[model samples]
Target: MLCYRKHSLFTKKYHIFKYDNEIHLGETTTKIKYTINLTPQTMIDWSINHQTKQLNGFWLIWKKQQKFFLMDATTCNLFKQTLNGIVTYGKHQILYEPIQSLLHSSFGSLVKMKYLNSRDSYMCKTIQKSLQYTDDDFYYQIEILQSLNHTNILKLKEVYNSNKNYHFVFDFPEGGSLADLIKTKQLQFKEVQLIIRQLISTISFIHSKGYVHRNLKPEHIFFKESNNLESLLISEFELGCRLVDFQNKHPNCRVHGYTAPEIKSKIFTQKCDVFSCGVILYKILTRKDLFDHESITYDEKMMLHLINQSDIDPQYQNLLRKMLQFNPELRATADQCLTIIDAILERTPTFSNFLDRFNLDIIYLIYL
Candidate 1:
């Protein structure tokens, strides 16, 4: 038997009975027994478990040769619902109810609440405590995300404030992140091109609003399945990827190799993001760590040495040098990178050319 509790919205909390095949509704033990075929169209049936006297949360059950087996419900539902959507290949699936939340620290202590609905799969990060500095950093991140709209940039759906926290909800990307993908292999040129284009577009959108994503790294860029073909980048905002920790208020702030030299000297601007973008670009292209792994501290000297010694394509090397210039004024801007990429596309035959060679339009549609 299955019991159901009517909750907010169209969501129903249901429980299952093992002995008697019936759906229990509220206090009445309704004898109505209906077997619903598990499919994408089926809503989660949640109810209270009479035996345990606790909520028998929604779950998926399977029958094999007259034996019944039950597993976590949300996992079954998420798999079915996002069957056509993006998926992480080797990462562990994080399972939790809609009410579950996690506490994280970004500059100060914060709370992240996950929105579990199919359409509204998002996470809301809220500043739970403010110490030493003001709330300007929090407000800045919120304002920057709220002002922009792009496929690459994580969309800020809404904002709320309470005495304890300031919350901002943004879109969730299920494909994990660029950092995770990089662990697999060096991205093909076409994939890199697509990623760079999306990144450029996101940076351009941010610059147009007089802000910079100072913390532009692989982890900050999320990946999601765009369609049946390729993955999309989902940039985290609202202190998730923003330079919240490195704000002017904090005298001692750092982001290891991704931080430009000028930024180290307190001379920072939007170009700082471009510098970080260059490091990220080099990392994706070479599938190498920006810095050495054995060092406990961020070895700036070693990073500089590697930057100079790395044998890369002359064109790419030139761009990297320009981006990492010690002088802030000498560094390339996001707009400049876009133009350079356009020129590169025009002058250089790309993997797209190879696609043309094979007449692989389907592959092109999948990636490009």
Candidate 2:
């Protein structure tokens, strides 16, 4: 929970609760933080660097005048940065960077640090050493991920192998993840289609490079800090494995809907990713899971029919059928899915679905 008690010189106050789609003004001493909700468009002008994981620049409105302040995570103190100097609320001299709050805790908690300089801000991801992977295996995986140069994949800057855990350094994104966004906003069709196209292309690139993403879903997908949808980055490559010399065990996907039917059988190919993407496509369009999130209970007789095709465009439904086919061989390959995505984008005139928009081109963008 975010907390702050107003101090002298800080007559005005604003507290921001961070999320993926939108940041909300949770509480303020003034009672009115913002007239309405805000996105990156509304936050066009700001002095703070978006990349800093700690509290950044934010805006608040009071007495018909707009005010801005930079947040200090250490003491929950707010400061206004101006051309002349900084106007602080509390006894603010100089604060050395401190370890801030944890960004995520479940999937191996990631701790974010407050940076004295904007460039010093970074994210630390620590994983427990498991029996499946040895020191050499972890290093090999990191090596593969480091070699992967793609805009859609998360960058691994440095890695440290310790006795108890493996630590990785990465640039922090301002926005959280697609999973975080979906919790609040019902994604529009056009937006979902665009995200789908980008992810499919990236997954296809991985397949072409002889690797399978083993896991592909909303939680793994992240957006850059500025809430730019196009800045989607897929992280968590520890589960990734090469197609040829596969060794690690398949991840448990019971909670996440993006697991393929063939995953349990241990007989799959690149099409497993197609199945996973298909699950995501169905979800964003309908906001309902193929199987219940709480339990896998589903009426087998009406599985496909339950998808509510009437609300979705026909092309999406058709694509879902191909990708979600129970037979692995019958499912669409990465290239085939890419073709369908291209056709859909070409047909829909209004949507700016830049189908082949992955920059890293005709010869680019793959993940671990």
Candidate 3:
């Protein structure tokens, strides 16, 4: 790729080329002839500015520590093309080591994949390519994942499409999904609170961005560390839909009980997401699926018994009531729920006393 720097008299040329399948940039001048390797992680930002609808040269901000490259139109296009095919198949194998182990294997397989050159590991989600999934669908999910930037949300590093499958490289949460945790042991009240707080905060962010995560069950929630329940991260956005796109039409709810009842009418909104969170909170607290036993028509008496169970803390019970309100308008907004939770936590001193009296053997979930 071609790059240039402005000198007092004229522009000095710099060149970027491939060496041993790795990209390199160096100045042409003999006095300062130097080359540096550039990888996918090195490219921080690349953009071509426009002024009043007119094209301008692109500024490529890449760094090992701190480096910049300015490329003209043709050079920028070439660099982009190189990046597009940088990790197609053969290069993907070269960059990332073989899959270490399987994390989940239901609809698709979630495997632990590590980098060849570094100790860092990531989860690779492999989904079989079928006619059911189109280019537009894949791109839309990519756009949504790229748009989200949050601490409690799983990060998508790269996407690879092979002949038979599509690979989504994601940050590996060592503790695994919340569902995994639930199947092993009952969580402390404080742990449940921490998970709910993080979930609501991230959900607030998602709603602000005009998107609703129709599915928010335990399987979609993960923890960043095995020992730290507070290090939670939410993942899986396949059922997510933009609010604007659904102004006139909406898809059916994918997660049966977790989604709000209004979704049956093909209506979805930010409130519906809040309702799903309410169901998750109920699940974590009671150690039971909210609608696991319900049929096409829910058992209203049983559902109410589960919701109004006396064992759940009164503060959470109150919050659940507002969140799980039958009418969408009566339901609490994520922001409102967050505020309520904050106040509840502040007033409840025992909220901080996690595992003070319970035996570690009784509460801890052994991964092995």
Best by TM-score: 3
TM-score of each: 0.58, 0.63, 0.69
Off by over 4 Å in 1: 1-120, 132-135, 226-254, 292-311, 350-368
Model 2: per-residue Cα lDDT over 37-148, one tens digit each: 3321122222334465444544444455656555455433232221001110111112224366555554455766444555466666676676655665566567558556
Query: Backbone clashes in each candidate structure, one number apiece?
Result: 8, 2, 0
- Please write out the lDDT profile of model 1 over residues 104-187, one tens digit for every residue: 565433223443334346655555546632356555555566566666676665444445565555555667678877887667
Q: Which residue pairs does candidate 1 place in steric collision?
A: 1-22, 2-24, 13-46, 13-47, 14-46, 14-47, 15-47, 59-73
The candidate, 2 or 3, that scores higher on lDDT is: 3
Stretches > 4 Å off in candidate 2? 1-107, 115-120, 247-256, 294-301, 308-310, 350-368
lDDT at residue 69 of model 2 (Cα atoms): 58
Please give the lDDT score for candidate 2.
0.63
lDDT (CA) for every model shown? 0.55, 0.63, 0.71
- In terms of lDDT, the best-performing candidate is 3
**lDDT, residue 124, model 3:** 79
Candidate 1 accuracy as TM-score = 0.58
